[model samples]
Target: MGAGMGMASDQQWLQLALTGLMVALLPLSYAWVKGRRDRYRQLVWLTLFLTFDLILFGGFTRLTDSGLGCPDWPGCYGTANPFLAHANIHAAEALMPSGPVTWAKAWIEMIHRYLAMMVGVLIIALMGLAWFKRRELRQSPWPATALFILVCVQGAFGAWTVTLKLQPVIVTLHLLLGLTLLGSLAWLAARSQPAASHDAAANRLSPWIALGIVLLAVQIALGGWVSTNYAVLACTDFPLCNGQLIPTMDFRHGFTLWRALGKTASGALLSHDALVAIHWTHRVFAVVVIAYLSWLGLRARRSLTLTRPALILLALIALQFASGLSNILLQWPLPIAVAHNGGAAALLVTLVFMLTRSGPDTNQKV
Candidate 1:
């Protein structure tokens, strides 16, 4: 069996850790040199920037069908990298030329892991600095500590994404956790550099902002479900699906959470109707999300303190709408699909950043 069919050994885990540490060095060095006033804050922002990139690259990995490129967790076929696992990868590729395992895909998958591990290492450094410099930093270490725990949980789901054979639920959760990590990091970065503002008018919108976050999260989850299940092309037509307003759908089977990929709860091959259901649900729910977010953006744009972020929010929402339509009309082109995912992340970060600045109880000073 190639690396895809075998399990990662103990030694391989050590090699992966070392590889992650090596990848982390550059970013760590940058934060150290540039962080004169607040190294912790610099690292936090750097980590956030890299985390966003990781999420985009992750989108590439998935869209390219490279999730199973290694077919094993933490390492490529029980080796540290694709180069070391050539024999196994070659064997698998030879067996099935067009299968999930291939040289290019193996590289893509391993690179994703490498980037994820790099992010993990940065988070660890962040938590360490948070604890050691809490007094000087004037920030709670607990948030960093919580971020640390969340990343571990995310790593676990990532392993499951591979080990469980790209099961839809596991993969979707992995995507969601990654975005959640990004949003959390944005919150930290905002806290690190506070903008002194107490706009009661803007602050009044905090509750609605909170609601927007919740709605966006649900939309993201729905989108993740569509992507993980490979249902993006189920209804290729844009405003209407399959040239019909309400096509036949298998909602129960489509939304069955615990089933394996491309299969129903009882292991039957998933029907086209089920895929339609998944895709259609995401498409319909998007109207509500888009409308609500656009309204929120317009509402927030009136406030001087929030105008910039509000503009960013509206711009990203437009990008999302355009990219999302292109995904369907363009037949799920890789670049547009990836941009759609990134747009969602950007929107979340924008909303969270705004929320952090505007607290509901704060009164306007100006």
Candidate 2:
């Protein structure tokens, strides 16, 4: 065990560097576009697009139980790609054919890492471009810089998710961090586009917009906890949990917030009641979020600048509600579960975009 782990540690850096080099090339080529005056804007939007896909793919990773496929951080058996780890993977699979470390699962895990690295590269490109052309870009580069830092923090959580064996807190935080990155990119992108109006009335809505963001963020975290702990199927029913309105719940354990994966801090496997608590909390919180956001969406529709995102918000909420229901009634189909995650991401981005538009566009000309 010691020798094998030592060898893995030795190869880890080289493999990671190779993976970074390979993934960086694509975004670097895109950013290398010659003489495009508005390339910064282009980069922002493109980064936003990639970040959105990354978040959705992350959900796919978690939902398919592929998080542990590679069973290592940043590589499969200390190799950059699963193909190179074929012997190790095959041996492991041969030992336990129906286990998590299958060929397909390894590929899914590596693809997620590759895509994550690609997104990180794009964020770096965005930060570099913003700084290099700060004067010409006419916008503060702080947001881009902040996003770069957030992605780094996210990368740490990604490592922790694997290192900690998908501990509930680490995995859920990983998901939340990814969504935060998406919202940050969306907010930054809005600055580059022309605002419909930056009038005083629109500015007045900033506080409420920020509040909505906070509420939605808490709601997303609750949802993430449910996903990470595999609690979505806890109730397996809509409007009622386990055929009862409240049911027996163990919030103390469910919301313990720092326990190991599938086990409590006391090293006991989590109980059904604990899972019910998590699922119930997320469901109850959704109602509050939906009601408040609906009102906000209505208020936003009155402002032309906010109208598009307001409409998008309503659509996303409907998608989210329906998808959440589908997961329960349809036995948690992969596509619908992934859609629920994506819908939550879209809702976040739309609201952040609206907030960006309503608030002062610092770079806007007189």
Candidate 3:
């Protein structure tokens, strides 16, 4: 009996060691790829690629209704992967065929989790690279460290989003955090590359471009709030919500961020009017953001590099507007609705890239 217990302990220790090794492998692999190129610019670009993929995968996870698929955190059924939880998932599905907890949903959710972990790994590798090359690379590692910290916080929010049963505030924050991460990575990438000699003309317009980025970020946050609360089709009419320029709205209830997922401050189920309020507020903000960004894009058309990104931003803005309208007119078809979300993300990335690129690089200061 004593020998058997000792053997069991050894096996358990070995299993944990293997798990740690596997987790470590992800960062190692990323570093290996990132180290091959002497140019920090290429490394930054690789991070951007992974970040973009992460945003898209995040959307896919949300659209598939897989947010709460695992019904647990860090793992599915306390296991690292879905395969181990197959029996439990199948049982849950058998019990509720059309319920939130389905095998497919579990797989999707777990896959998202794995992808998120990989991103975290990449960020860690990025920070490590910055640290290792701090002597040669003029860029600071502080930003990379901050990004890694942000992703960790985002991961915590993601877990809460599941454990708390998809709380609206938490979900909205998760979305916003993802975009913030993307923007930060874009800034890092822009800084890594050698900027064309300081153009006084571009420097003159820097403040306005920065303001545009700030406004766009605020608008994106509002949009995230609207999406989190499932208020996209609240009005279902263009130019006016519910056919009125100023539709009846319960601003208090709609903007209450700390309440239950679908409940009001009074503990009553959220009303349609509350959703309309939420959606309408976002719509109004969207108009302001669109007009400002369009003007900025047009103004920046003279710069060769800035021109293409500006045009892409304009095109995505149009696509987002149309997709949003379709969601209302077509009763929120899933494909168009998802595309609308994707378009918002694309617009955010494009604007971030444009603003970063448009800035005069004062390498003299750093």
Using lDDT, give the best candidate's number.
1
User: Runs in model 1 with CA error above 4 Å?
Assistant: 1-8, 360-366
Worst 10 residues of 1 by lDDT: 357-366
lDDT of 2 by residue, 1-366 (tens): 999888877787677766776876866677568427678887788879988998999899999988989998778887878888999999999998888789988998888888898888788878888889889877678888899899999999999898888898999889989998898788777767775655666577778888999999999999999999999999888798889998999999999988898888899999999999999999999999999999988888888677778888888888899999999999999999999999999988888877877876634731
lDDT of 1 by residue, 1-366 (tens): 556444447578778999999999999999999997789989999999999999999999999999999998788877899999999999999999999999999999999999999999999999999999888776579999999999999999999999999999999999999999999999888877755466877888898999999999999999999999999999989788999999999999999999999999999999999999999999999999999999999999988778999999999999999999999899999999999999999999999988877775333211
Candidate 2: give the clashing pairs. Answer: none
lDDT of each: 0.92, 0.86, 0.78
What does the lDDT come to for candidate 2? 0.86
Ranking by TM-score: 1, 2, 3
Candidate 3: C-alpha lDDT: 0.78
Candidate 3 pairs with clashing backbones:
none
lDDT of 1: 0.92
Where in model 2 is the C-alpha error above 4 Å?
Answer: 1-12, 361-366
Instruction: Encode model 3's per-residue lDDT on 13-90: one tens digit a residue.
Output: 454345544654754566467757664555567767777777777777776778878898767775666787789888
TM-score of 1: 0.96
